[model samples]
Target: MSLISTSSPSSKTLPILRGQHLHLWFDHEKTKALDDMNYAISENEFVAITGPSGCGKSSLLNLLGTLEIPTGGTLFFRNQNYHDIQDLALFRRQHIGFIFQSFHLIPTLSALDNILVPTLGNSQQKKDVTERALDLLNMLNLGGRSNHFPSQLSGGERQRVAIARALINQPDILLADEPTGSLDSINAQQVLDILCEIKQQQSLTIVMVTHDPAVALRADREVRMRDGKALDMTQVLT
Candidate 1:
């Protein structure tokens, strides 16, 4: 691991996402989820945010995903400031995809339907979205499980569906919070392999939050957090 400061400039390409002196507080400034955090993620880079519980890893991920706004400081997507984006939901739909540890699939919906959930109010035609969903399922090796419900599928299978769903929208950034946290080692490795392949094939930028150092090692860089701030950012030598 090559240690680097959070404020260091990237020599390769401009950051797809960047944060400076970010702060997120709750309950009238009582809970500071993010305190003076600074970070940057280059395009097509796979970066991991790792830390102990309540260290604000997920909170930072949420801010990057545009699911939550910061209380202070600045966040930028390329040259665009986050605060300048008026419609956060539309911005997310166009630029971000999310995966969670729990799968978060609807028990009543089939795998394919669940995958199509993100496309549900979009202007795209139903046929097009369905075709894309099927393609994603096939890519994740879950084509045969398209009709399987969350309850009917194994944990790994359900997670695969969630992965497919995240890619269905063709977002520029994939924000994953503990995507493999609930799986066994074998399944976790499988999921990481798929993500790697996806990144190569699609040139996707992945920002993942994980507690496992092994998983963090798989990323191009790791941003370790503590006390709601980035302690350091390190480039992983492959």
Candidate 2:
């Protein structure tokens, strides 16, 4: 785990995340999953990474989300090299939140407990954090389903629980990997709408990887990838 401070990001800050000449390898076979990928994301900007399957979108997301360090080059957060940080888990817990297509919730835990999981063992007051968890569940339209287990909830409801869990620590950045891939069209659209709403209200930067063009189009900018390198980047609405 890497060391992290619980400081909030200011609006005037430039480039919340930057990666230059990044590379990643696996096994002794030297399979370069990420090859010289470079990109930057500004504060509160909604950016999407889109490409064919196995094009390294998830790999890039992992780097940006601080789940893994680059094999080469550097990754900077708020102009600071993240490599220098020693407690990566602390960094993730304090600054980065992740959402996956699978919704990764525990089947036995109630929706509220799942949301409150991340807030445990931290310095925040338990009662207050529990209240916030309930609020988040309600905000995501799961107010009446707090006691429901993941098995009992619908696909959309489970994903909403995952979102609430991710936001429990009030992270500065949200990293999502094919967040809508497993859902039907209607539920996917609903999830995207909720994401946009959260971004506007919280002013948090979001970097998402999506195979669906419609989902990618919702971002402020899209970076296209091929052969593990970014290319033909374009702005969507800015």
Top lDDT model: 1
lDDT per residue for candidate 1 within 6-61, as digits (tens), equals 67556346788889899999999999999998887888999998888999989998
> What lDDT tens digits, residue by residue, belong to model 2 across residues 1-238?
7588678566466688888788987775367778888887888999988888888889888988777777898998886798888888888899988999999998889999999888776899999999899999889999999999999999988998999999999999999999999899999999999999999999889999999999988998888898788875343223
Off by over 4 Å in 2: 1-13, 233-238
Q: How high is the CA lDDT of each candidate model? A: 0.90, 0.87
| Number of clashing pairs per prediction, in order | 0, 8
Checking candidate 2 for backbone clashes, the offending pairs are 1-87, 1-88, 1-89, 2-86, 2-87, 2-88, 2-89, 3-87
Which ranges of candidate 1 are over 4 A from the true structure?
1-12, 233-238
